[model samples]
Target: MKKIIKTTLVLLITITTISCGNKSEKKEADSKKIEQTEEQQHSSSENSIQLNNGNPWMANIETTQGIANMKKLMDNFSKKENSEAYTQLKSSLEKEFGTIITACTMEGESHNQLHNYLVPMKDYFEGLASKDILKCKKTYNELNKHLAEYSTYFK
Candidate 1:
């Protein structure tokens, strides 16, 4: 079942990415659709990321590097906490997400587990897109916690 979900996710992302191309006009709409799909998948599956039989999952170098870069981006945005910095963080994160996906070398259960971990971050990123500073700050706090927790599952 997990494999089926992962396969579906990969196909959806590939189709979305190809169809959207470089059109910024449709990027936001496409992102919302992807987010909704991820949200549904996350809710239907395990509530949180699982351990690999009581140990952290061994992540690929690109995945680890991308996550580390995203953490840095979030940290930098935290220091500013302005609309500009928030926008920059969101943009940087989107780029890192692409990097992670493109450079992914993991396969089988490990890869599926990685997707399970990534899906929820999309929600927080969506929240960061809002215009409300207070709400963004709140979401930022949650996102920061989520990023910090990444090391516990993936190395």
Candidate 2:
């Protein structure tokens, strides 16, 4: 009877050890799964920041080119000092800037991130129509500064 009781106690201990090991293995697996899920969420957020087609830098280059073209148009008007032509040119510039703002604002990714650049651009153009030559020149410089910073994000 003593020998039988000893054997039963040993068997119970072995069974408990095996059961505890399985529980520990299951806990480890659950922890790993949670970690993988978190990593996937992080990756998706990063992907969203990237432009569609995975070439966000290209958009920045294009935006810079557009700003350069606008500056050139403004320079020509400034050089000519033709009030009538300047008036029309200024109006066109405002419209183009408005379109750019609308497009940028409509974008899903990085819209808020880009608002600092776009808002100043809009404000500068809004004042262009009535600005004197000196004010226009100042605003042009300001616009160029903002565009330069904006372009750097792409680079």
Candidate 3:
């Protein structure tokens, strides 16, 4: 299922690019979709948490708010029979994942490496959001191992 989702997303992105006519136009469109300056890219949030400085798409997820929200969402995900809440949280997480990857696209070869790392995390996040506590715990542990690596290379 995870593989399917990843494959589909890759195909969709490819199709979208093909539909857009050319690579340069797609890059322009993706960038122009969020028009932020380099300074705005890494602006500190109210909590003084910095987002990814390399891409505008990372502004929301790399912040303190994003981390806090993810924690809260994971906590809520453990509740029994909370279908409605899971629905909302899952949607939000998926949207944020999109933002993260789109930001990756702005960086060329780095995008490929980042995409490789993030894809599995995205799958785990989806699993957690689906209210699978065991999966969530396992994924969280997996994420901890990768966090340092992400920080080291992404900057």
Candidate 4:
């Protein structure tokens, strides 16, 4: 009797586990509703010219590339050199900045401030390569100032 009871219990458990994998129609409908809600939350920037904080270069690359990566690199900067992060940053900068610069007129009002911010970013990478921690920190500060100026004017 005990053996029969154990066998029946195991069979019941197995059936229950197998049934759990199957989604009810209600569960499937709920999932579809969640997906639809998520799709509606995104913004549609139509004919929009976004500034890089305040630069005439139209758009924020930082957000697109996700500033979290930059924040991570900066936080771990002194530990060891990250050539991969450096390379990725440079590549993203080129694509984003190139698109921005190309879209604007050469004589745009915020061109100098915007361009100045871009140049030192490369300098920061160079400083990293040469192990000039002080110089790299200083360059970051300078870049910060440039960006502040950009924000003041273009926005």
Candidate 5:
């Protein structure tokens, strides 16, 4: 009787442990599913910003054009090395570009998104205009990373 009782008790504990582990696993899987669902929803909303007439190539071209223009502006600022003027220029450019992105992302695909995306590129140039080259480089790299990430989502 003693032997039977001990075996039964051990079996009961084993079963209980197994059940608890299964519950925790289930909970983790459910949580992951919820997170994935939310990400999908957000992506869908962002993708709703259709390329003008569904032309991805044209959209890419437009985006490149704006980037090129901002690069040119940045080059000009670097040549001047005027910190105060560059700061003002950078601020205004950021504002204007932000407006364009907001308008494009809001609804109705517009040239505005391309414009806003250029703001950071302009910042990169303006940063070079400052005395602190390292700081400017860091900021420029960070901005580029953000733009790369944002572009991936749009694509």
Candidate 6:
């Protein structure tokens, strides 16, 4: 009787585990699908930065100031060679980003254009917090390039 009871319990546990695993697998697959869709959307041409009649787009004062502040933060951070300083720089940059978003007064196509340029910046900022110092350095260089590109696309 004890052997039968033990067998039954083991089978029940296995069945429950299998059922939960299937459900989680399905959920994970669904999540991947959504992420792919979003990635496609972001990568689309409409989200890309383009010039207005071959001239740089006019950026709002707040947005321009925020970018400048972030650039300054990056400059200071580059002088320091440590992960902790990079993390702090990331925090400061995020705060400046928040200020830009809060003070945004842009409208219509200009606003859309600004968003196209700004959306990918968050990913670069996220990379700054990486555990790998080499990754952080690469991200920093990419972020610097990204910031410099702002002038090319937006004045």
Tell me, by TM-score, which candidate is best: 6
Model 1, 87-135: lDDT tens digits are 6677789899989999999997788889988888898887777777887
Better of 3 and 4 by TM-score: 3
- Residue 85's C-alpha lDDT in candidate 3? 54
Q: Of 2 and 6, which scores higher on lDDT?
A: 6
lDDT of 3 by residue, 1-155 (tens): 99999999999999997887787788997787666654456442222322346542332234324434554555555543454555565676667656554543335544444555565666665664555656655655555454434544444
Candidate 5 matches the true fold with a TM-score of: 0.39
Which candidate leads in lDDT? Answer: 6
Q: Model 2, 94: alpha-carbon shift in Å?
A: 1.9
Candidate 5 per-residue lDDT, tens place, 1-155, comes to 99999999999999999999999999999999999999999966664433545443134543444444444444554423344654655665565455444544333344444444444466565664466646655655565565454443343
User: What TM-score does structure 6 among the candidates reach?
Assistant: 0.71
Deviation (Å) of 44 in candidate 6 = 1.7
Per-residue error for 148 in candidate 3, Å, reads 4.7
What TM value does model 2 have? 0.44
**lDDT of the candidates, in the order given:** 0.84, 0.60, 0.54, 0.50, 0.55, 0.87
Question: TM-score, each model?
Answer: 0.68, 0.44, 0.39, 0.34, 0.39, 0.71
Give lDDT: candidate 2, residue 66.
56
User: Weakest 10 consecutive residues, lDDT, candidate 3?
Assistant: 42-51
In the range 7-38, model 2's lDDT, one tens digit per residue, is: 99999999999999999999999999999999
Alpha-carbon RMSD of each model: 19.6, 13.4, 20.6, 14.7, 7.7, 8.3
lDDT tens digits, residue span 1-155, model 4: 99999999999999987777565666898999998877665422321334556444542444323333444444444433444444454455445555555554534534554454455456655543444545545554554454444434343
Better of 5 and 6 by TM-score: 6
